[model samples]
Target: MSADIVFSDATRLAELIRTRQVSPVEVVQAHLDRIAAVDPKVNAIVTIAEGALSAAKEAEAAIMAGRELGPLHGVPFTAKDSIDTAGVMTQRGSPIFKGRVPDTDATSVARMKKAGGILLAKTNLPEFSYWIESDNLLSGRSNNPWDLDRTPGGSSGGESAAIAAGMSPLGLGTDLAISIRGPAAQTGIVSLKATHGRVPMTGIWPRAPRRFWHVGPMARSIRDLALAFSQLAGPDGLDAFATSAVPFDAGVGTVPDRKLKVGWMVGPGFGPIDTEVAATVKAAAEALKNEGHHVEEVHIPALERDFALDVFNKLHVMEMKPAFREATAGHEDQMYTMAKTMLSLPDTSMEDYIAAEQAAERLRDGYATYFRDYDVLLTPVLPVPAHKHGITELVVNGETVDLTYLQGATVPLNVTGLPGLSMRFGTSREGMPINVQLVGRWQAETTILHAAAVLEGVSTVRGRHPSI
Candidate 1:
């Protein structure tokens, strides 16, 4: 009963509660119990929401009273500590902000609650939500459920770990570069990083580089991603960037009338990728072709000319350092590795900064040109599967590369402000999860979500979860 409750996706859980086959209180309690059982091993949870059970009881009362319920009513969802949650400790994974509680929930959190989701808990993250691993002085590091020694992958790592370990059925995670999708890939879960401004980053921290930042849902199923995106999309009136009046449909498995053109690539632009990971990308392309879509291997020349990672570093370092300087001022003692690293890096020269801005435009233009002909693009989410915690370097295909190269395949979407979804399609020889990325044009989330659901239907790894 506990396994069934904990592993069920948000969509299924909502159905069960709505039908009264399972009480809201029971659903919430089962998750709380699962957290108590596994969080110590995973360290995914930083602070449990004290009001969670009470909220569940209230949801139960509404059902008993025949009151209308929200779509997620009774379903429990977690948010990364970086995302503000009213009355919950959102410490931002640093001692400088320890014990701090926001007076209001982030737009993302409030919307999840508005749809009937219960606030389950706050999960761990890197300091100031920077870096590629979940470790920080505040809540410590999060370990992969698949292999406790391997990291879950960063800033949003704890959110990914919680869902992977059955501690949370759904979660909200922020992405700047690889944070959201990369962690989902590492954990064998599914997460969406919608177009830059599609989902507002209103209440997440480190808004200095807001252009590349995004907030999206992480879940065990592709349908949950679609459902959460439908609820979370549109302008909130506060975030100027989120002023898109675009219409979104939770169009899971909606087959298109014409054959969708998909291009898959693992190299030349994204740097070296593991052979196994590369093979997984090919397999996904093959599966799509088998399903009768127009599939072919293709590359964008823009990516080759202006490497997205280099552009991001040049732009973000200039934009982000000021925020770090402000936050860590006089509290340098509490600063973590990522904060210190950011401070140590030299500022981008005025000439380099302007060049990076132009390069960013080029990258965006590159994707725009490709999307003109192709409806979807497929690529590896990470060069390799989850690696041992604290690894500062990785050897991909015999060439030693900086650990940041793991962001190689993911940062392009951030630079281009394009929508991308991460879902597991294969497993490494070491049994770690390998996920493929599905990308679409700006404001074309419906297309990628549709593609994701179709690919999910044929995934050999569908329904697989960590033994933990």
Candidate 2:
């Protein structure tokens, strides 16, 4: 019963709660049990909120009293530790704030709770949400459920792992570069990095390089992503970067009615993608074409230039350094590895920073122009599948590449503030999940979600789940 309960989608759980088929207390306890059963091996959920059962009881009483219900009433969800949850440990997976608890929830968390979702736990992440792997001195490393020795992808790795392993149905996660999409790709779940400013970052950590940061949903289904996105998006008035949000409807986005124009890729533009990954993406495009949408192999040469990754790397280090230094100025010894990493970065000239911003503007304009002709852009979220945990290098098409290339296909979206999603397409020979990325123009999340939902409908592997 616990296994079945944990695997049910958030929407389904909501329906059950509303219909009195299952009490919210039953739903929440089932997940708490699931977390206890698997979290030690996966290390995904770092802290279970103390009053989860009390909250569930309240939700149950509300239903019995015939009170109005929210969209996610009684559905349990997790959030990355980097996102604040009032009265819950929001340590950001760093020792610097080991006992940290916030008075107010992050805007996204607050909105989710407002919509009737329960915050049952906080998931793990790299220190300060800084790395591409989920490991830090605070909570240790999070392992992929499909392969214990491999990574699930990071920053949002724990959130992805939790969803993949059925510890939570859906959750909130932040993406600076590949934090959301990369982990989802590796763990065989789904995640969205919405258009910049579509979701607020009011109570999240490492709120530097404000322009590139995005908060979004990581879930087991695109429908859940749409549900969570609707609740999380919109200007909160606290975060200046969170501009106006467009309305979202999962019913509309998942309907398979639109004939989309999708541009598929496997060029030098996306860095050294594995041949298999490229084929999987192309296959998705072909499947969509067969479904009556236009599909073409295209290239935007700007993405191929070294400057695409270089510019992001420079700005990320520059913006993150000052904030991290300020946060840990007096206790350098207590700083996590990633916080110390900022000190190791080469100093960037003000001219370089200016050049990077200009380049970013050009990238944004280029993507905007490209979107005029294409409805969605499809690529591999990562050049390769999840690899051994703690490894510093990865093999992309037989060539060992720097670990940073893991976020290759992803950062360009941040550079342009486009909305991008990662959905599992297939699996590697080792049974590791491989996912393709669907990127849409700014404020066009529905467009990509529609296309991805269609692809998900036709996917042979969409029904597969990790055996944790």
Candidate 3:
């Protein structure tokens, strides 16, 4: 029974608690037990909240006293170590800020707490949440739950691993490039990278490159992602970028399902994708077509791999490094390798920075044009399935490519400030999960979610779990 409790998703767990079939205490304790038994092998969870069990007991008492409960009244969730949680340790997977604790929660964290979600713990990330793999001196690297030797996909890798292994039902993760979608894809979970400023980033670190950073939910179920997104979106007033008041249509709650125009790509245009990963995306498109949606292979312009990385690097290198340099001034030797290398790179010329920004605008224009005709664009979340930890290069579709190409499909959406969701679509030959990304126009999460819901119902990978 405890095993069953731990494996349930947040939506189902909330229903069980609301119906009195299970108490809040049972739900929290079950996951705590699962973490104890399984987390040693994965190392996904970095810090367990000191007050979780006590809070769960209080939730149980309130329910027994006939008090009304919020949507996630008793369900436990985790946040990436980079996100703020008042009074809880948020070491950010780096030794520079070890023992750090914030006095106030991030806007997203506070909103989740207000909606009755419990913060069970903080999960791991790359040092300062920067690299493509989750590892740092503060907490060792996090291994994938499906294959212990492979990576879970970083910056949000730990959150993805915990959700996949049943240690947490839902989680909050931030994405700059591929953090949320890529990690969720590698682990066979569902996650969203909402439109820029859709969710606040009031208390997150490395606040430069402010225009590109996003915080959203990563969960085992698409409905849970939608639920959590609705709770976290809207202007928090503290974050200057969160000035818009857009709400997720959710495409649920009595809206009848209808056909959607989906453009699916296995690219020679974006980057080289493994043959198997391409097939999985095509299969997902066929499933969508069978459901009466208009699915087709569409060509998009300005998707050069060079342009994507150039724009990201121009802003990331110039803007994101100085803050870290300032933060770790006295403790240079303690910095992680990737971060140390990032700070040591030669300065960018002003002319190059301007050129990259122009290229970014073209990339945005290309997506804007494509989205006008198609409701959503479908692509593989990563070029291949999770790769072994510390392995740098990959042979993708017969070409030896730099691992940075993993974000080929994802980073473009971030550059455009468009919304994208990554969900489990198929399984690899090794029995590992494969995911595909669905990109939608600005503030069109509902359209993407509705379309994904249709395909998800017919996907063979749904509800499958890692043996971990």
TM-score per candidate: 0.99, 0.97, 0.98
lDDT of 3 by residue, 1-468 (tens): 898888788989989998999998999999999999999999999999999999899888988998989889989999999999999998888788899999999999998888788899999999988889999998999999999999999899999999999999999999999999999988999999989999999999867788889999999888898889888989988999898776553445322355788899977556788888999999999999998889999877678534586577776688887887898899998999888988988878899988888888888888888988988899999999999999778888689888888888788877789999999998889887899999888878888888788878998878888888
**Residue 226 lDDT (model 3):** 83
lDDT of all predictions, in order shown?
0.93, 0.88, 0.88
Error of 1 at 349 (Å): 0.4
Highest TM-score: give the candidate number.
Answer: 1
Best by lDDT: 1
Candidate 1 stretches with Cα past 4 Å from truth are 252-255
Candidate 1: residue pairs that collide: 72-116
Model 2 global lDDT (CA atoms, 0 to 1): 0.88
Let me know the TM-score candidate 2 reaches against the reference structure.
Answer: 0.97
Error of 2 at 276 (Å): 1.5
